[model samples]
Target: MAEITVDLIKELRERTGIGMGDCKKALVAAGGDIETAITNLRKAGMASAVKKEGRATNEGQIGFFEAKDCIALVEVNAETDFVVKNDRFQQFLTHVAEQAADTKPESLEAFLKQSYAKEKGMTVDEYRASIVQTIGENIQVKRLSIFPKKANHSYGIYTHLGGKICVVVDLEGASDEEKLAKDIAMHVAAASPLYVNAEQVPESVIEHEKEIVKSQIAGKPENVKDKIISGKIQAYCKENCLVEQPYIRDDKLTVAQFVAAKGKEEGKNLKVVSFIRWDVGQ
Candidate 1:
């Protein structure tokens, strides 16, 4: 390795879309040549089998795994959402997730440490590295969410556009309604609701919205603050609240109103406890 220069680091970042630190390190090992740096990183990711570790990988796949009482939905991102459809990466994700069902690793590190029988005796991390070389982008396990079903509650899962996104919802007060469950799951998939209700949204998020609203009203008179605050709260609720969001089927009414009407007509009690959405390109 040689002494890496700022220009070399900048050039490598531009060429490979990798982070500055990684680019410089690669360049140092490659005698400060941009092309050599790219080759070095590629080889490193190959032997280690994982490249571009933690570089805002917003691409990959939405994987689904369901067990007796537990349902898991994951969003694995690569550098580009286009790679979400890559056969190699998708297969790797499916294999890893299926293995995750039986292997109870407390954290991702532990999970990676659990070896795979089909992996030619490579650790999970090594497997990931090999897969990344084939895919040629920074890959990350962006989101991993598990929903457990209680005796009274039920689970539903849905994915769209070949794993472009995934949605999982917990429906409470089940009444032997498989179709309704699927419908709610698909609704979650298509609508991509942020939160089930206003109460579920974190206070920090609410405070952030309030700050944005406050800034918008900065030039307004002091007497107008209360009115601005009230309007801003309404806006915040509208954006974050699932019920306040317009139904994807028909924008005439919000999901809350739609659900209420349907529940009334069906003579069934149903409540959405929580919802999760993972958008592939987002």
Candidate 2:
């Protein structure tokens, strides 16, 4: 039997775009013959996924999974909307989300290398490769997020438009907890606010908005300009900050004001601790 060196595995993986583990297995099975290994990978349908890796993946679905103390969000992308509806694709998303919910890996790279939750012996990357083979389309797990609940916080998630947009909100203390958290998630899905609060807005973004506002009022005096710019900045913050934005359910009250009112009534802290919004392909 020929020795299957690391060089052989590397070459096979480069040629086939199959995972390192599968490439090594193919090489060993083929007695270290690169051509034979390639043939074996092709026969197993694993090689097709590599070729399709460059295809544009603008359509897909967002999956949510929650356990007793952890919540996860996963976005998997495919080349077309038709594939999004495929049971295989949906199953793959579920598997990925479950893995995310279970492991809570710090990064996507780590998640890819972590052991798959449902498939006992394979890594997530390997499982994804198998699905790519089965689906006959390039499938990419674009992002995975895991948020473990804090002792003082409760979480809520909302998916709208069949997973086109998903929102996850973390709130301080559990006061009117379920309804408040859910309504906040719904507001995030609809309004698409960019930051949790004014503090989260970047200084560079504020400066950019200031420049645009200044340009719009080019002829104004310096003092008047300063006042106008300050007001514009406040308005911008209100528009972009989740807590400051007018609540979708009732525009008369800002989200922060609504939460504060509810908190006072319920006798608990109700601050928006943090949130994440995922819009497919964005």
Candidate 3:
């Protein structure tokens, strides 16, 4: 059998985040095979996976990556804010974002299993685990969003407060309006509209808003109540929908109006196709 050395124990400790003594014991028991040692530690319930599994990872950064054909956003969470600022953590976040943009996985689970772009033969989740070992915190790639580019459409991507908030907007009917799209993205960062238009707002949400409005005006006459409720629901859509909301730069014009005015100047019919906004830890 091969003799376990100090260097071997250190490597195991670095990979598993297990204590030095436990790693040494596992290495010895597995005859200096790192993979086998990891398995043994896990079977013994003494690995870092068990130790860090339950920690709340409420803090981290949202990373944004834009490719020629798609835009990707990834949220990586850690146990504390301090780790988010670590050089290793930031590098990991960037790599993961790029990986997401390249692979365009359909879901978070699929993204986690995709190969890490920076390192060959390593899955994204494995890379995350390596970072967790280095940083000594619970790290997770919480979510991923990918927006595929459409022909004759422009995309705007914005990151605010060092990526605590990231927004992406898709605009149709013009290909050269990147600045317009970016401005809309910035507005989204500020205004936080929930849907692109009133039509996009769900019926259930409108009904819920109506319920709240009706309860507030319960003493009004039944005939008056109908008119007030209809007006209030319209107002609610104006507040929550992107196209109907007042533009962040000019409150006098709705976002839809602002886009339409710009489109008229360019002799094109512009439209807000869709938008996505991600707030860290939410």
What TM-score does model 2 achieve against the real structure? 0.91
Q: Which ten residues in a row have the lowest lDDT in candidate 3?
A: 41-50
Tens digit of per-residue lDDT, candidate 2, span 118-180: 888878877887888887888899988888877867787899999989998989977238668
Badly placed stretches (over 4 Å) of model 3 are 1-46
Q: How far is 168's C-alpha from truth in model 1 (Å)? A: 0.9
Off by over 4 Å in 2: 1-14, 19-25
The C-alpha stretches of model 1 lying farther than 4 A from their native spots are 1-58, 79-86, 132-143, 189-191, 211-224
Sum up the clashes in candidate 3: 0
Q: Write the per-residue lDDT of candidate 1 for residues 151-194, one digit (tens) a residue.
A: 76656677788778677767666635555556676877766667
lDDT of each: 0.70, 0.87, 0.87
Provide the global lDDT of candidate 2 against the true structure: 0.87
Show pairs that collide, candidate 3: none
Error of 2 at 140 (Å): 1.1
Error of 3 at 206 (Å): 1.4
